[model samples]
Target: MHKILVVSDTHRKDENFYRVIDIEKDVNLIIHCGDTEGSETQMQQLSTAPMRIVKGNNDFFSNLPDEQEFEVWPHRFFVTHGHRYLVNMGSTDIRREALVRGADVVIYGHTHKPVAAEIDGIYVFNPGSLSYPRQEGRKPSYLILTIDDEGELTYEIKYLELF
Candidate 1:
């Protein structure tokens, strides 16, 4: 089984993001949807797992790609920061782009709202923001993706309990 951690929109304040890395120490892969605000290097150093990070709207000088596509065994994932796709309106545009890329799963972050749903046979997920959350209750959130040996996929959205 492979465990993947999905997070985004840290915007340079990484306290909660750091906490998540500590909590999910055994994750096999780390996916940062975007908005690291120039802290991608430091964040990458915190985990031994290979990481895939993209350039967010806030990362003007970053060299990361706008989007990335890769395979984790039986699943193909397309990762992006979502601003270019206008995701705040909805997932329609991004979903179409993902379909064109032949991705089985599309992951993005921009609205600072967590979403987990299967649309038209494709899995759509956003882990929200670790620094600034816009969802109700305003909890920092992330997503845990698990792929079992049988190639079945499961997703769970987790919120940080701030004290």
Candidate 2:
């Protein structure tokens, strides 16, 4: 199986970043949903796997793309920081954009809340925030996605501390 690590909204804090990197070293792909707060350079150095990072609203100094669409062979993903999509209000904007882009899945981060659900023939996911979480109990978190050779996909949310 091929594994992918997904995280977002670090906001310049990286206490749990290395921990995730160490635990998921077997995974060669990492996706940052943005709001890194100018920590791209450090994240790049510490990442053992190739990383795809977007530009969040807070990433004013960075020139990363606002959104990205890529494939893992048979699986297409739409990734964005979500401000353009108005994620703080809801996922409608993202849903519409994902559909237009012909993506199988949408990965985004903006609300600092962990979300995982399949909506309207598409998969919508948010890894929450690794440094700051706004969901119930407020525990930092991230996500792990695995794709089998047969193209089957599995996902799980791993929190820094048990809620």
Judged by whole-model lDDT over C-alpha atoms, candidate 1 comes out at 0.94
- The clash count of every prediction, one per candidate, is 0, 0
Q: Please name the candidate that would achieve the greatest TM-score relative to the true structure.
A: 1
Candidate that would win on lDDT: 1
lDDT (Cα, tens digit) per residue for candidate 1, span 1-163: 9999999999999999889988887799999999998999998887769899999999999999999999987999999999999899999999999999999899999999999999999999999999999999999999999999989999999999988
For model 1 the local lDDT of residue 20 reads: 92
Per-residue error for 38 in candidate 2, Å, reads: 1.2
Off by over 4 Å in 1: none
Give the RMSD in angstroms, all C-alphas superposed, for model 1. 0.7
Superposed by TM-score, candidate 2 places the C-alpha of residue 60 at a distance from the truth, in angstroms, of 0.6
TM-score of each: 0.98, 0.95
Candidate 2 global CA lDDT score: 0.90
Candidate lDDT (C-alpha), each: 0.94, 0.90
